[model samples]
Target: MKFDVAVVGASPAGLSAAASSARTDARTVLIDRDLTSVPNANTIFEGMASAACLNVEPFSIHQVRGMRLISPSGHSLEIDAGGHFLDRKGFYAHYLNSAADYGAEIIESEVRSVSRSADGMELFLSTGDVIDARIVIDAAGVDSQLASSLGIKTMRHPDDVAWAIEVDVRHPGIGEEDRFEYWVGSIAPGWKATFSPAGEDMATLGVFVRRHGRDVQRFLETFLKKFISRRAGSHPGLERMRILGTRRGGDPIAVLPGRIVDDGIMVTGGAAAQSGLAYSMRAGEICGDVAGRAALERDPSRERLSEYSRRWWRELGFEYILGRASLERLRSMSDDEIDRLFISLSGRNLLVPGGLWRKSANAAFQLTKAMPSMLPRFLLNLLRF
Candidate 1:
């Protein structure tokens, strides 16, 4: 089959890319290994969902008012951030249907390999069929087959990838909670333990640990015990908390790939180390619009397709850099240091007004004031990028 644009993977990124490309009048196709599997549950800010043009209300299971940040020593801070917990199966179905409505062909086939063709690019599918396209967008997750076949390096630091495990549980106390909870510091080294309640008696508990190998199950077990005890007193009946399901995956938090765009191809989403649901969706849209136009213009050259990279870097690059630096700094600090830092800033509100830069600056100032020792390292980390 031949097309103007072909997107690999049916992730949020791939679906968005296909829809955007087709919307631009380009003949677009989206291929995935399996369309029946449910997507992992995730939470995103309401603004982010809107910005990505996703009508999340239909699939939303719970409305989130804010987040409670818990320190290692039990100190806590509340931040007001509006968002929602979505039912993944319904959400993906909605997105998939929307992509089809935009005239993008959806294919349930694995792309075994990708190679350069005289005209543009060729996708070798597991079904013994080949697809030819003027431009290709790789939105496959961390294990992107298309990227690997093309000899492209998609992760800057593989070891920095966060290994995570989450489980859905039915607990009596979770139904009334409106705020997401995050437990930071040594509880889950290099990342955090998260409690995201989806509905009354339905919630997910997960832990993300970087450089911790594959023993994340142990971390989850330990965290579950501690969390249950803390929330339900001494007689917290662990037997009553029914675990419905489990999911595991790698999160490329600080390992952003260096090159995402090349001749006749562009990479977005987890494959390119672009984490975050809304962020990846937005990136896919930008990539699709650029690649679609380039395909129609018959100019899929690296120079011509570099516009996607330029636009993405101009828009979300700073936020990514800042977040990476902050995460790296957090990873370097001891549990005690984090606890002390949280204690010092316990009563201070972090939801300040202004753009990302100003808010970040204000946060830095607040951190420096609370713990003067972190200022030098924080400044150095920010300056390193």
Candidate 2:
């Protein structure tokens, strides 16, 4: 088969890339192992949903008003951040349908490898078929075969990738909660234990452990026990809380790959360490639009495709830097320090309603007042960008 742009993986990034490319009148194809597979449930902020043009109302299972951050010592801070818990299957289906509507072809086959062809690029599929394309976008999650084939290192270190284990369960106490809960500090080590309610009687409990040696199950078990006891006020209903399903994967949180675009290929999503859903989708759109124009102009060189990289870095680079720095600072702190910090900021609204700069400034002010010692290090981290 031949195409102007070929996107590997059916993740949000790939779907948006295919759709965006096709919208530009490019012949786009999206390939994946299983196009119908349901993804793990996730939350997205309202601003991101707007940026991605996603209709959250139709697919949202729960409307979130804020987040509760619980320190290891049980100190809590609430931040008003509007978002929604989406039904993953419905959300994926919506994107899939939209991509098709935009005239992008869908292939239910795994891409075994991608190689540069004389004219463009060739995708060798598991089905023994080859696809030729002027440009290729790799969005195959963290363990990306295409990125590996091209020698692009998306994760800088083991600690940059978080092993996550999550499960959906039915519990009486988890009913249509407006806030997502995060238990931070030693329990989950480099990350946090999360409780995201998906409306009536259903919620997901998960733990993301960084630099963990494939023993995330243990962390999940520990988190479950603590979460149940804390939320239900007892362990009496623990046995009755039926687990519906489990999902496990690697989430690239801290570092992104040094390179995302090459001679005729670009990488996005987890493959490029673009972790968040909205962020990945936006990256995909930028990548696809650039690739589509480059392909149409018959110039798929790295120099031409670098526009995607430049645009992405301009739009989302600050946010990624800020988030990574914050995570690093949190990882450096002890449970007692986190508890004290949370206590200091307990009643304050951290999510100031304004632009990113204003909100970041407000957060910096509040955090400096709470933990004056951290200001120098945090400022140093930001300056590195």
The candidate that wins on lDDT is 1
Best by TM-score: 2
Candidate 2, residue 233: lDDT: 56
Lowest summed lDDT window (length 10), candidate 1:
230-239
Q: Candidate 2: deviation at residue 69, Å?
A: 0.4
Q: What is the per-residue lDDT of model 2 for residues 165-201, given as tens digits with 9 covering 90 to 100?
A: 9999987757478888888897654478888888888
Tell me each candidate's TM-score.
Answer: 0.95, 0.96
lDDT of 1 by residue, 1-385 (tens): 9999999989888888898899999999999999987656577777656655667777778998989888887888888888899889888888889889999999999988888999999999999999999999999887776776777776677788888899998877674588889898876544788989887788898998888796688888888877886787632574579999999987877876668888988999888888888888888999999999999999999899999989988888888888888888888898899999998998887777667778788888888889999988877887886
Which ranges of candidate 2 are over 4 A from the true structure?
234-236
Pairs clashing within candidate 2: none
Model 1, residue 365: distance off in Å is: 1.9
